[model samples]
Target chain A: MRARVLVELKPGMLDPEGATVKRALKNLGFSEVEDVHVGKVVELELDSEDEEAARERVKEMCGRLLANPVIHSYEIEIG
Target chain B: MRARVLVELKPGMLDPEGATVKRALKNLGFSEVEDVHVGKVVELELDSEDEEAARERVKEMCGRLLANPVIHSYEIEIG
Candidate 1:
């Protein structure tokens, strides 16, 4: 199975990198860019054939290391 | 409008960061992790109310700065 994990900052949190990108975009003429937030996506290939097992395992991985739960939220999609 | 841009390395690309993460996971007992690839998600808020325009603009942003087309491919989702 294959898993796609998306980890994003919690609402109301500040994102320095995103701010930088927003500034750069504005300077580059994309003035309509009002806000930006940067996040991570991890794609994993697992040995399990069962989608449920793979999703559960990847969620565990996210909780353990892939995401910082204090400041971020994550979602998992398995195929 | 809002846009979510997912940028991922093209197939056959060497992802040292992913390899490092994979090794760390293995060391931490996630032995079922066959492979890992890390990517980026950039969420943007735009002034336009039109979803199509928002997606187009974000795609242009990806083409110019958010992603390296030669090594990465990006998908834009506007809502």
Candidate 2:
């Protein structure tokens, strides 16, 4: 199974990287960019065949290793 | 408009971060992890209404600032 995980900083979290990117885009003339948030996308190939189990495992992975419980929230998609 | 950009290292590019994560997962008992690739997800809010034009503009942003054309490839989705 292939799992795609998106780990994003939770709302209200301070994201210096996102702010920097937003400013850079504006300077580059993408002035329409009103807001920007940077996140992590982790694509993993797992040695699993069951879709439901793979999804569950990926979620566990997110909680334990992929995302920080304090500041990051994650969404999982298994294919 | 909201635009989502996924910037991924091109296949065959060395990804030390990904390698480190894979190793960490294996150490954490996720031995079923065969491979992993880490990428960047940039979510943006733009002051645009046309979805088609927003998509094009976002792609241009990816080409110009969000992604490195030599080692990274990007996909853009506008909503």
Identify the candidate with maximal TM-score.
Answer: 2
Candidate 1, B1-79: lDDT as tens digits:
7888999999999999899999988988999999999999998989898787777888889988999989998888878
- What lDDT score is found at residue B11 in candidate 1? 93
Question: Root-mean-square deviation of each candidate, in angstroms?
Answer: 1.3, 0.8
Candidates' lDDT values, in order?
A: 0.90, 0.93
The reply for model 1, stretches above 4 Å from the true place, is none
Number of the predicted model whose lDDT against the real structure is largest: 2
A74, model 2: CA deviation in Å? 0.8
TM-scores of chain A in all candidate models: 0.92, 0.96
Candidate 1: tens digits of C-alpha lDDT, residues A1-79: 7888999999988899999999999999999999999999999988888888778788889888999989999989888
- Candidate 2 lDDT, A35-55, residue by residue in tens: 999999999999999999999
TM-score of each: 0.93, 0.97
Please state the error at residue B2 of candidate 1 in Å.
1.4
